[model samples]
Target: MNTKKHWAVVVGLGLLTLSACGSSGGASATGSKTVTLVSHDSWAVSKNVLADFEKQSGYKVHVLKDGDAGQAVNKAILTKDNPQGDVFFGVDNTLLSRALDNGLFQSYEAKGSDLVKPEFRVDQTKHRVTPIDSGDICVNYDKAYFSKHGLTPPQSFDDLVKPEYKNLLVTENAATSSPGLGFLLATAAQYGDGGTSRSSEAESGGGWQAYWTKLKANGVKVVDGWEQAYNQEFSGSAGGKKAKADRPLVVSYASSPPAEVIYADPKPTTAPTGTSYGTCFRQIEYAGLLSNARNTKGGKAFIDFLLTKEFQEDMPLNMYVYPVREGARVPAEFEKYGKQAPHPETMAPTKIAANRDQWVKSWTSLVLK
Candidate 1:
């Protein structure tokens, strides 16, 4: 959910081009049959998933878990001239345009690409990336804490800026976290401060910056990334126990409460928390063959495997994300507790790509500074 990583693409592309081109890192295979898949830390698969892929495709699979979506994509781009891995996964809609524009992928046209649902199939023109999963970034509130304080959960973006909610919210920095960027985008769309035309200044005009100014005055706590905001600060999550953070509101996924149940110490009969549907921000993840792969054939095969029923079916419970492939079964935990918004805010990839950097800049000035 860290869309903030894309800002690096805007400023670091030139350096990446030069540095990557000068290296021969991924040109030769270290092991004849081994094919590496580079992905973000959040990516997860069943224990034997790669082994199954290896058995089916006759290729040894190595997964390199990078820092986050933005970091992974940026690393891929920086190494595009000589890719360190054969395939790259975890570039979401927010970071998709930057990855595509940087020419980080090679056209593979994996056979199972058609199996993806129409709503999730984002890359039609170029066969560079294939949709694999989707999720909703939303604000999750501490059910127990809110009830204890006799305070109602915020119902909308407007409610967040109210005096009653002061010091009760914590969000990741838009410059470093994907969900942070997502929540910022939701506010931008809600306030008419998004898109390329708007300036990133509070005094210069009314837009995302102005909205952020009001949020800052409401005593919002801004952290570096989702891990800190959700795990260290949000009172609802067990992770908050580590830091004793009592902030009841945080930016997380709609499916997070269900995930907590699924991964609980003693599996819970029901979810212990809930998410605010009003804050949902749709994020779609994609995978593609990195250009100049040492094992292009294996890379294409891996992408095909990703879209197959086997991999898709393993996604929901393991990764806490919805599979993009049609006919993939949804886990019962998801059906029971995962919240979905009736109408989550959305912005075109083009507009987001064009305005993302400026919006983050404005948000930082208004909120962080």
Candidate 2:
């Protein structure tokens, strides 16, 4: 969900009014009719769909596009006492605990909570956040690069450490990017926490830390965020093509191939990129009413509107994420090119929260050093 910013084509939606502001600015004044929504840069909605919400609810929506998901969440936490907007969106499962621990949101059960898929729901008792969309953070390969090199793209995490695939992969910094953290968590899930009780040949007896060490040895490149990894380093993306990027593999979304196809000029008959489904981690994004919001009522209404069928159905192209609402229809391109991973690696939020900080510290020492 964080790297959804890679789909740059959908970002220019003229109908939705936006304010490019940081968390410290652009907050709505008290008693104002405008309800501001602060989110990561990828947020988008069709003009008519957003118009429908405003016309029906009589509350004008003003969106503030913060940086990426990680940056936005950190900024929101710093400003929780005086938030930038009424509602905050783009906090994903990877960072949900941080926001919750800091008391960034006030609980409010959305109107159509029952419609959300059961698997995506979390914090059921508190209702501090509402599940909005889900996607898989995965490794994407350049089709042409593999074909031209007579190289079979790496399929799984283990394959990456093999000699043949060395120097062909790039990923974001785990401490600063959602997809990067997801990939790190995926390895931690695949190989247990290096405890003696879970020793196995697949884990190489040292667990995720060992895995990352091997990945670093294999020449995996690390960038600051998804945009740099996908658009500037990955060979298959549209931005990468213009930039003449050389890395054939990048950590991005399963939905990336469809976005490539859909945005190409003369739309390709088939996607130029493909996902390595084996190297995927599930990611779920959420939205909530910011604590100390000026327009509590408007914030509640907007959160409810997000669960509506119209908004859910409009998400695929706009945000490149799957709606969490059951029975929501995805675009044809998504179905054909970006089917969800059958068994994406996942870790419980509790496990992630308990170990995330240490893992990042270890990762920085092992990989970035």
Candidate 3:
């Protein structure tokens, strides 16, 4: 999951107006002691934890938030020759191949590479990027809405297309949002690209495309990004509750439920939302030293700091993501309300790289039309 999807709502409405921490350009123009980090809008850290990194590395951190994950990665690629910053963060598994294929990053394995969980590691031969955090993209339901209507919240992909759930779902655009793309990939993984197998009542012989046809027919709604879908359309989020959003089901991160509990005004005894685990897709986010960074040393050091225990443990509360570091402790709210799915849908990066664009194009034509 991209933290950009939930950080604003999780932390406070004040975070919604967050801007670039410092001016643009590399360390050479600013100063040798300055390190610039280019990332999506969700980048966050506790002041003390970051102060520790600054003290240990002797580099003042400057942050530049480009936009959502897809927009940020595309912008970084366009500016790769004279990149906006020394390091780039917030690129995820969905867009990893595009970043690597564009030669956006240089090879530099961080200091604590061994501490990262093995499953999260990629580009093993090149060390082009370091895995930072991970989460699951899944469908979430408004518990109160379901209970009030005497309806059981959907538990699986098959359940989403049933008549009872019609016109009740909302999702982000697959071509624009990371979680939206992750959800698209989840269906692709569940129903093979062109396989004729009918795995369930919701599945068709035509594979994922046919599944989308059913989803679209069920009156699924599409929005441009996660914030709009979750905050303005889905009824489960605190923002949605205030907005009086009607859709009860939304494509969001599995960790969203805990955020609802942790950030509520009165702080509910239990999460107000729930995840449909069967629809989950594993998402991993990474950071790397820009190919022509002016502050290579500072960038590498910052990447190393990301894997430290202190930084890893601070991530859940700040960014609403699971650290890739093996021993990182998750917040109690996450443990009690938002456990990761036991069997999230997954696909190899190589497979995603080969098919992602075509799938998105086809999905756009099938569902968005």
Local accuracy by lDDT, each model: 0.76, 0.85, 0.85
RMSD of each: 5.2, 4.7, 4.2
Higher-lDDT candidate of 1 and 2: 2
Candidate 3: stretches off by over 4 Å: 1-23, 196-198, 202-204
lDDT against true structure, model 1? 0.76
Question: Can you give the lDDT of residue 72 in candidate 1?
Answer: 67
Best model per TM-score? 3
Q: Give residue 216's error in model 3 in angstroms.
A: 1.0
* Full candidate order by TM-score, most accurate first: 3, 2, 1
Q: In model 2, which regions exceed 4 Å deviation? A: 1-5, 8-25, 28-32, 196-203
Alpha carbon deviation, residue 223, candidate 2 (Å) = 1.7
Candidate 1 off by > 4 Å: 1-27, 194-205
Candidate no. 1 TM-score:
0.88
* lDDT value, residue 19 of candidate 1: 29
Clashing pairs in 2: none
| lDDT of candidate 1 over 1-369, digit per residue (tens) | 222221111111111222233223343644657778888776677769767888978888777765567766777788788788888988888888898999999787888877788877666777888888888878889888888989899977777888989999998888888888888888777667633323233334466666678788889998887777877898888778567888999888887888777667898787767888877788788889988788888788888989889889888776778887878888888888985566787877888999888887777777767
Give the lDDT of residue 250 in candidate 2.
94
lDDT of 2 by residue, 42-76 (tens): 88898999999999999999988876777677778
